[model samples]
Target: MSQAVTLWIPGLLDALRVKEAQASLKDLKLPALQTLLAKADKFAVKPQSFYEQASFLFHQPGCLPIAVTKASAELDEFNPNHFWLSVDPVQMIPDRDTLVLVPGKALQITEQESKALLQKFNAHFAEDKVELIWASSQHWYLSIVQPVDIQTTDIEKLAYQSVNAFYPKGNAAQYWRQLLNETQMLFYTHPVNEARREQGWPEINSVWVWGEGKIEADKLLIRTDASIHSNHAYLQGMANLTQSHYCAEPESYQAWLNQIAGFSDPGNGEIDKHFICLDSVADKLDNLQLDEWLTLLQQLEENWFAPLLQALKRDEIDSLLLDLGQEYRAHLKPSHLNRFWRFKKPLNSL
Candidate 1:
């Protein structure tokens, strides 16, 4: 019989124990909560391999962090609801010992990677057990309990018949990738990394789950791969991008787009369509910050961007626009052609 032996080192165990899983952690508030699950781990296979070597989690109005939860929490003004904060029954982090989390994306890894993944994960994850109930690419939940003593084939059969199966196509896939990358970095250098590695544990290269509060071993729980701990360029960029945003004037652009055709919540089946429409048409206009672009709209009224601005203004969606205009006025300079961008381009290009 192949016996599964897990590594139990001091640094690793202590580090995992010192997590925000306890109820007392809620007192840390939003800023502190943001500090957990960093972007780079020193013990990673590669020195500076913080996963999200790309992208950012900007703090713009629409691009705020979206934390997942079962129900909405009337969080403090500062914390509020963030993109990283998901509030759905599908997402739940258990306060109890054992927990299960269905990732929102597909993660590919090998058997060896699986063991390393568990050790690396167990190191910083202050949990007793994780019955990582996973759904195969075919959308069938495989009842395989990780780090547990139970082996139930019947449960696996039942899961195959009933397990939330929804593919994370576009936006979700991107978010999941970012999350895993950041978590990998955090776990890499986490005190647990060296201890676990010494025990011959591999690394968690990739993985995915259906969603939050996934059932494992007849228990309900939630899990998220938000751990990140790194000072590398990519990690820094992820942090910055998650915090910064290009605020532009002329908010009516959004209202104007809404007033016209092609705007909707599109539901789950057509989420890709929703993002494409919003990103291509509406968000594109809202994200523009060039002073000349706004000027062109205000002056010519016949310029390419003029009609859109006029529509937004006519629809009375001027909150962000007004704010943008006010901020730009506070620090206007002839040299600054665009309030959002500083590129030296042709005036017509504006």
Candidate 2:
């Protein structure tokens, strides 16, 4: 119970830039966040994407490896004891200049289509002891008899980007690359793609395998008193392993408040810590949805920032922590709110 609340908001700078462009900061009602920012201590850290930042919170390099396939397996109700890797179905669009791979999340992929595709993968790779499991149309898992040492990039990270640059890296990079290339060719003329084409659906041309690792016993070593709440599978897995309370994502800030309104005070006399993940902006950015991203920022100002600011003023929370991904985090205590003389700058100023 070292913290009263930790507000996890990704793409703060991008949101800020959009907000500032659409309207002036003074026009927005975010006094709590603004005041805290004006007075809170700030530091620079390494730049990382939302997934990278989230991954580091629970798993230390080597201590708590990110068994993404296993975590995703739990979501799919698939067995987690086997060695696995994430293999997302994607559509590769060839351009006159370059070829881009659009993530499956952006396409309309059905469960039946996924099952058929996975069957094909399993049949083709059966001799190699590699099998593909359809967790969902967007999430697929690859099970192998032996572990793969190659590190691959997240599919979301490569969405709408060139696939040529995403060749696996590490000891077994060549084998993985060859396997992936072969699979793409195998899927190119699959009956599923033909059926999808007839039905006007995007083709499942390739798969991106990444987050390869086994679930380590020490994956939950970073124990914290903070309660975990998120809609993400990985966070839920982390919470389950850490034995912390896990709540589904709230549709509104009011819903979230209702869920944690009665949090019991730790007997150690420390304030209860609440960790929240609000990632709509990041998701929008990945999908190139600028308008939706801007709208979400406006809603955040009205729902989250305004309400949390009022909560702090009422002394319901001891402090606020904003994780803007990477090394950019703001720690704001109630006392900081009183620093009226401190200059309030826009988010991009930092």
Best by lDDT: 2
Indicate the residue-level lDDT of 290 in model 2: 47
Q: What is candidate 2's lDDT per residue for 1-350, written digit by digit as tens?
A: 22477777676555445554454443544554566667776756566655566655433343333455236426545444656688878888897766698888778888888888888988998898777766777877766556767787877678888877777899989888888788889998999988878988888988887778766665445445556667777767666655566677665668877776555545523226667886554455545454554466567777787777777777877777777543467777767778778976664444
Q: Which pairs of residues collide in candidate 2?
A: none
**Where in model 2 is the C-alpha error above 4 Å?**
1-3, 15-29, 56-82, 95-99, 144-146, 222-224, 261-271, 285-298, 324-327, 343-350
State the lDDT of candidate 1 residue by residue for 210-308, as single tens digits. Answer: 222211222211111111122222223223333221121223324323332222234312111000011122223334444432332343223212442
**Sliding window of 10 residues with minimal summed lDDT for model 1:** 1-10
Candidate 1 colliding pairs, count: 42
Best candidate (score: TM-score): 2
Candidate 2 residue-wise lDDT at 191: 97
Q: What total of clashing residue pairs does each candidate reach? A: 42, 0
Off by over 4 Å in 1: 1-127, 133-304, 312-315, 320-350
Q: TM-score per candidate, in order?
A: 0.21, 0.82
lDDT of 2 at 78: 47
